[model samples]
Target: MSSEHTPPPRQQPTFLTAVAALEAVVADLDDEGFGPALGLVGGLFGSADPSEAAAAGPRLAALLPDAPPFPRAHLAMVVGACVEQGADPVACSGPVLAGLRGALTGAQRLVEGWERTGGGPLPDPEQDDPAEAHERIADPAVLDAWHAHLAVVAWWTLHLWQRAAWAVYAHPAVRTEARGSGVTAALLGLIRRYRGEQHDLKGLAHLAGMLDDEPLLVLDRPTGTGYLLRMSGLSDTFQLHTLLADVLIGGGHLPGVPQDPQVVALARTEFLDGRRVIATGAFNLVAPDGSWLWNEGTPSDIPVVDGVRTLVLDPLPYERSWSAGRFIQEIPGDLRLERVLSPAEAARLLATTAPARSAQQAFGAGQA
Candidate 1:
């Protein structure tokens, strides 16, 4: 067909019409309607006709006024469309961004104010304490709403980052603007937060191991520690594996392994002293039965040492354990010491560590 004669795709529904359609779909919980709504929104903004989009902008802005916004999947489709049309995503949503920032600031201030008033302790179901009843009168629902709002906000922010990264990866203009405006740092921050909250090591590993760019790794080290015990160097392989283990262990998703002799041997030498065993570098252990124990936790059934702090196997990998709330809430109160590796140091080590040789290379060198 001749280019001029070929019919153009059907024009997208008007912006207000699309928003109404979306609200209807959500009200009916119509999964099928969602796709069409998204496509329509994308088409409206993504189209070459700026006048059409300009006319729709105010209506769309009015419909999306919340902070840490919602219906992010739909918003992302719209943003993607704007990006495709060679329009600035920020410019298209300038009013919405201002509203969002204001909403977020207000929400944060409310949370801070609540926290300042000592927002009362979590209920002690065991005691049914009289004080707990008094605390409940202070509108616990407000706290719940605040937390839910924050979670939604966090999710939308991540969606924005993901869309931005997708745009940068595909659009040269996006790449230029992103690089100029410190969008990379924002993207990384979102990725880090997502990884921490969602236990998504694979996603993080993919981003961290991107071949096109040097990954940013932050390191923290303890002073007055023995030099030999301090961690150094960065290895992508190690970092990826460490993060994988952390996510798995923290989520309680590790698989069981049969007892092996090599595990016993390593346990004897590496963990014999009963001091918290920390992995200074990544290493594979072979059980006596010739089975591999690539990533495993310390024996869980063993009784914790009395008066001993944490027994951190790799502090950097489990830095989340060091958070004040985590330490107070998750760790046993009696544990004498907290064993946490510096996540910063671990990340640094991972960045600097030499690439591991392939199995073939090791065998060829007679070092397997």
Candidate 2:
């Protein structure tokens, strides 16, 4: 309820969302609320307009004084993020850099009174509040290791997300036990790829949107580093980060076979980076009424991919979440559609009173 808050750019679609997220954490924060600002850091990193993003530098700078290295380290990083997002470098520049320059000149050590002022649960980079990672430490060496690593965080441009993962692992104090803690293992995967190593495949979450749904694709088969997410890899998008959730997923579909090396090579093209490359997955969409029907020529996990029918996984409830490849796929995997449906289940839940093929004169293909 503070009057001094920097007003959000109302033109941006997520303005209300940003306010809500901030309010959820600390409702009574005034303009200078450092904790509230950090909780809203996601909004800052995700600013869509260049002019809006330009304000991030000084905004984040305001928090450095009241924060630990966790946030002080973020001071320089905010500028780097704005640069990557295409904000005008000089316009986005602010007095924050002077403070950033001065802070780094000191030798790294645990803050003078972290034990008295610290010790909390570790935060989940994806789901929890970013400022909640502060907690006191009994292990001075590990705390010192965390202190040194966090204090030195720079742009880390290509994978800015590593900064957060590194922050969490840097604190083994088990602080801010929010939820979801795969960040450390995920980071090691980055290290492995940096060394030119191989990783096994798992399902990856394929994110989507309204008809113009799902972002684009990137094939990450690399000589120097490995892929970010595998097509047949892990389906959970949090394998990246929340920032990644909005930025990386959903590249429009390009048809290919997973077993063919040529198709796989095509998938690795630079065009698909930070986007999804298709491999026989159905992006079946349904109406708000829970009707899983689509007219021909609409793109995505096509209900019919090259003659094979797709099984729309859990589409009885129409929504965007089920539109990803993981939810819709070529018929036959671990899931099977049952012929047996109770009259109520089909008529009400499935939105069909009877099977009418193609609604031919009101008797087309549908529930029987």
Candidate 3:
């Protein structure tokens, strides 16, 4: 036995093995394991090159012609993977985007089917196991939720393609190796705008769903302050330490405060005099404007002109209503200011908030 046993057919390299595994997942797309299989494929080849995507594209495309609408949307995403991986933008973008649009149309059809059938409540993946939830898409509400989620995914893929196309022609912002291009910055702005529009739509949908609705007041906080104080109900926390980080501080897309100029000046005076900034009426109070005050030795009262409202920052420490210590205490021991998060990590936070809100609506229906 010690004589010349062929060394176990030399195991494939890790990258090769990964490629095989991803190809297998793509091959299995039509099977019962479609959900997990799609996820596996994404994990394996999401960042892989066009060559890798090309290897699996045939198998992925095999199922798409007859695939269900939701699954079809997933296939579109897989197609995006190939495009993102160094494909010729002009030749490929048109076909790829066309395919994605078709997927979106299919998704819309699925939603229509749900509405026609009067489908059931949305499934919570956290609350329900995969096996139980896999085949439960008959419900309209559930389908709507899925539609929203999928739309976000598909649009994100498109956004990425736009970025990749932009990168080809655009110059880098920094000459250093890891520097971002102007394309990336532009994409960020587009993403911010898209996210804001989506968020405002969701907020409107949520608000409309409420039984006793009140007027909406959008507030923007002043920028350039060393710190932002966030108040939701009686609790206050520094913006950096908030659960969603800077999102709560600077992620407003709606119009600003609409108070009279005279009222804003008076508010500024009260703010300067160290009056507590409290919500008197029903308002969607948001963060302050950047660079409005914070300089010139006095904090500017966030302007509330038209419908835009800015945060009123007090330059004087003794005159301020919120204490730094109080805000500091609200932060958890585990929270860190400077931490790099993977997409997966950042997504987990969003995963909780959206589902929780959905669950509230789902369960609250019985109470009514």
lDDT of each: 0.35, 0.30, 0.33
What ordering of candidates by lDDT runs from best to worst?
A: 1, 3, 2
Please name the candidate that would achieve the greatest lDDT relative to the true structure: 1
TM-score: model 1 vs. ground truth:
0.30
**For candidate 1, lDDT tens digit of each residue in 283-314?**
23222122222332111111222221111222
Off by over 4 Å in 2: 1-33, 55-69, 91-96, 108-368
Please, what is the TM-score per model? 0.30, 0.23, 0.27
Q: Which stretches of candidate 3 lie over 4 Å from their true place?
A: 1-6, 13-75, 90-106, 109-368
Query: What would the per-residue lDDT of candidate 3 be over residues 1-368, giving only the tens digit for each residue?
Result: 47775566765334235545545654655455556555666666745656766555445544444444445555545654554454333333333334434433433443344345465543332354433333333345556556544533343333333332232222111111111223223322333334222112222111111111111122222221221232221112221122222232223321233333322233222222443333212121223322222111111123443442223221222221221211212112111123233445434322322111232442364355
Error of 3 at 38 (Å): 6.6
- Candidate 1 residues lying further than 4 Å off, grouped into runs, are 1-68, 89-144, 152-161, 196-368
- What is candidate 2's lDDT per residue for 60-123, written digit by digit as tens? 4344443444344453465455555544443333223323333322111223223244624322
